[model samples]
Target: MTQDEKGQLKALLRDEPSMRLHRELEKELRDDMMQRLLTVRPDDPAFAALTQFHRGCLHGLHELWGRREQFVKQPIQGGNDDK
Candidate 1:
């Protein structure tokens, strides 16, 4: 993450309002992904490629969400490490 992004994340971790907003954002993203996945047709030629792309997108989103949750759960100490 960039230094500015890291600083913003730290600020979010320390602020309840920002944390709540993050949770809401995550929920919205997940819901939107689900909607898009549901719209994909299994018989379409593009199905396989689209499915693969969606899977990767969801996986990345989940990973980032998990990381954010972990960051918020733990106390913010000065560190560059993501995990």
Candidate 2:
């Protein structure tokens, strides 16, 4: 992701309560997806779709949290004030 995008995410996560709520929601979604996956057989028509959706969710969350970690450790850069 671009630095600007990372900065935006950092801004979004800076609110402690919002961040906590986001994490809680992420966990709930993960748990619910896992339960849904349990209902599908490998050969079922919807299994592929469900698994893909699950993978996408995991990948997205991974990216988001990874960026969050980075921003937490590093200071955000100031935008171009001289422009």
Candidate 3:
């Protein structure tokens, strides 16, 4: 990720509860993937597919997090300031 992407992720993590949950879930999934991959043989195609799937999942989670952050930062309706 670029520095700007990193900054956006940090901001999202600060303001969005769902983003925090996503990051925690992603960390757990990554750890589980690592453990499962360790049991697979090097030549196994399933192992490669699993790794690729996790990569895609992480990428999607990051994109969602960025969008959610932008959403949360937007002004609320009725001219509310409490949000």
- The top-ranked prediction according to TM-score is 3
lDDT of 3 by residue, 1-83 (tens): 69998787677557667656877988997998899889988799988998898889888877776676565556456755566
Task: Choose the strongest candidate by lDDT.
Answer: 2
Question: Candidate 1 clashing pairs?
Answer: none
What does candidate 2's lDDT look like per residue over 1-83, in tens digits?
79998787777777788678778968887898889979999899898998788788878876876677666657777877666
The lDDT of each candidate is: 0.70, 0.79, 0.77
Show model 2 residue runs off by greater than 4 Å.
Answer: 1-12, 57-83
> Model 1 over residues 1-83: C-alpha lDDT tens digits?
69997797678655888657667866776786667767878787666776677677667766775687575657677787866
TM-score of each: 0.40, 0.48, 0.58
Candidate 3: segments with Cα more than 4 A from true spot: 1-13, 16-19, 70-83
Which RMSD values do the candidates have, in order?
9.6, 8.2, 8.5
How many pairs of residues in model 1 come into backbone collision? 0
Candidate 2, residue 67: how far the Cα is off, in Å: 9.7
- Give per-candidate clash totals: 0, 0, 0
What's the residue-level lDDT of 83 in candidate 2? 67
